[model samples]
Target: MIRIRLGARGLGGVRFAVSPVGAAKDLLRLVGFSPGTLTPQWRTRATDALSRHRLGLLAVVGGGGPLGYAPDFIRPEPPAFLTDINTGLHQIATTPQERIRYELAGAVNGHAWDPGSGHPPPRQLLRALDRGEDHFAHRLADEMARFWHAALAPSWPVIRARLEADVTARASEIARSGLAEALNRLAPNLEWRDGELLVHMRTDSIHQLTLDADAVILTPSVFVDWALFCAGEPPGAPAPRTPLIVYPAAQADCLPPAQDHPLIGAMRRKLLAELSQPRSTTELAQRLYLSPATASYHLQILHRAGLVTRTRRSRHVLYQRLGGAT
Candidate 1:
């Protein structure tokens, strides 16, 4: 069975009905980081704060192939952040001696592969998923098993399994008690929705919470992309953002003739038209049929061209078509 859990040490709660791939992708979204193969730097960057907060970790695990059950799992409720249960799991699952045992066990079956060990790193695993590349997922699953075996089993499971259980139990009680009362008394701006079970941050505030979940599982680290949404200005307040694409107006004499640059010319026209109406990365990506990264690249080129300027309104950066020469 693909067991998934999302909670910290003392407070356990969030649960979800998702596939392993979905869980992994969701976690990646939360942390504001890209996924693909592995990278040396990724280990340091993703886990640094995890080390500090020692705050605990949440997991979303699932399996459907021969090794997993098919019932599908879902988080009946949202979890409260109290302690670091998942991180505690990592300590046991990723330790040296334990990792060695799991690695060798898998290696004997000719399955010992580490996506993060070689170049390209494992983030590509996710990149491939984004592109709908099937082979990549198969290859990733094969290697992912080995990676998890080495990184999370024997070594990390020892401590993680125990802590996760405790956290999950307490979280359930806290949620049953109606957290809004304590939450409001502590910080008035937060709101908890019955359906989504998410603690909505109405203002610039930080508060601790406890909650419950049905199943609990742990992944290695947090996904880094959620920051773009969670840390931004309050919802409905024009989400601030910088221009993703800039282009010099061909009519302006300063920019080199646009006759030779169709890409630049097209972008210039589009930016000019959109100058009055702001669009988000997602909207722009859909409109242009380009990946967010590709859109960002085009935007960077435009910024360098000086055809557009950026401004910060609250936590968001907005782009404006500037009347200037490149």
Candidate 2:
């Protein structure tokens, strides 16, 4: 269990940010062995891509081994909402070597893998860290950039829209209710009371964090499942300057089980299949060989049934499937 004691000013200091790098890191976690925790639909989508690019990404981020720790450098906290992949790559490239080394050492030491029992860190990676080679960091960053472009870039638009929607919904919750109410709703294991935020972690140990004057950055993540993760300075270190709390985004409810129900027609089934990612009406019309008006009509029906959601992006309005619709 982790308990965070917030000062009187903590409530006013809360802020929110969206990080592309963080999302990419979460994707790494999703592709790991524990992906079974993910929705079956999303797991299938991610695994299909992983099979195609397994060899290329394997060298950098090893297989789903017991000592599975992607270098901590890849998970840098963004100072602001990351607008593009290039900006996030730049952040990874420019991270101070000292910080990178510190985080890497911590990951290695804190890992619970039995020595020589499971896949170990890549030989090249171990050598690079031992010899303090800067090239290794650059190579890791390059590989991450390549993986992002090939595997995740295609789905980024939909992912970003979902993240943005979550932020807007959270802000509305804060306005309608209050900060405490919003915080409690973030996850089942979180509670705000007595000027402290309590998080029930899987572990039995109790850890307390004090946020005296620093604001906690609440980041909504699509790939984070189960428990909330707190990122801040290591225990007993210097007072934390910037702290982040990441919680899972609310997923759409599971698709209704009556697939062959009379209410669901052929067009609605096609729309649901294509909605794995968000699409504008024009895009849907072009792909489905239907007129824009027809596509819009079906979309409205799907929206009413709570099977999909719509959001306006600039001049275009996009719709995406909710939950794990088959």
Candidate 3:
């Protein structure tokens, strides 16, 4: 468990910012990392984007691999100003020499990644790190930019609107109930006590820090399925940033048009696109050249995500896409 002792300055400066890159990176994790591993709801959503867009560079770099202990440089400190994906990319491209060396070195199994680690950074990524090449950073940023254009751009308006709405709602909650109550709602793993925010992590390790920064950024996430995340760079680690906590916003998979939500699978989106008229699962399956069971499974997922509604008409269970699962 980790505890953040909020100093008066920190307490007063609690603010909300939206992270385009953080959401984008974690979305890659949800879908492209491993199949049938975790967060099926969110994973299925992201699979749609990945299936439609070939993130060649990101895939080669193992950007979405099981690297829970990946370098903190990838997760830059949240800028005080709510940032766009380009801003996030600039920060990554301009990572300081010291931080690049420190965090990348820490990723080897013997370092912080040990005890629990994901797949090692791919050989190519490691080679770039070893050579201390700046091109590696630019390449990474370019890849992320490509990914943003390919996968995130089309749905960014919906995603950004949802994030803004979440922030507005949270601000209202803070106004109505108070900061302590608002903090408690971030995630079940968190609580407010004795001027400190207590985080009950699955890991047994305990950490406590006195928060004396400009602000503690409270960001809302759509890609993070279940857990709350707190990310901060250690002191003297490159450009310092405000500490950040990411929590799930309401209806995390609320994007509708089923065809429009990038978090869904490509196959499902195809099925949904065909659902301008009510159709049976078997009908959808045939239209998409898929098995009935496959169609039914996708339909069920769409139903659960509030993207489609089903009805029974005598013999067939007909499903149609919802206008907007907002």
Q: State which candidate has the highest TM-score.
A: 2
Tens digit of lDDT per residue, candidate 2, span 166-284?
88889999999999899998877778878877777655353444444346777778776544544555555332235667777777321113343234699888988899999999999
Evaluate residue 250 in candidate 2 and report its C-alpha lDDT on the 0 to 100 scale: 74
lDDT for each residue of candidate 3 in 58-128, tens digit (9 for 90 to 100): 54443433434445555566675478787889988888777667656655544333435555556766666
> Which residue window of length 10 is worst by lDDT in model 3?
61-70
lDDT value for candidate 2?
Answer: 0.65
The whole-model lDDT of each prediction reads 0.31, 0.65, 0.66
lDDT of 1 at 116: 36
Those runs of model 3 whose alpha carbons end farther than 4 Å from true positions after fitting are 32-67, 110-121, 206-214, 227-230, 233-236, 254-326
- Look at candidate 3 and give me any clashing residue pairs: 45-263, 45-264, 46-263, 48-265, 48-266
Q: Model 2, stretches more than 4 Å misplaced?
A: 39-71, 111-124, 130-133, 206-213, 234-241, 252-296, 299-326
Which regions of candidate 1 are displaced past 4 Å?
1-132, 179-196, 199-326
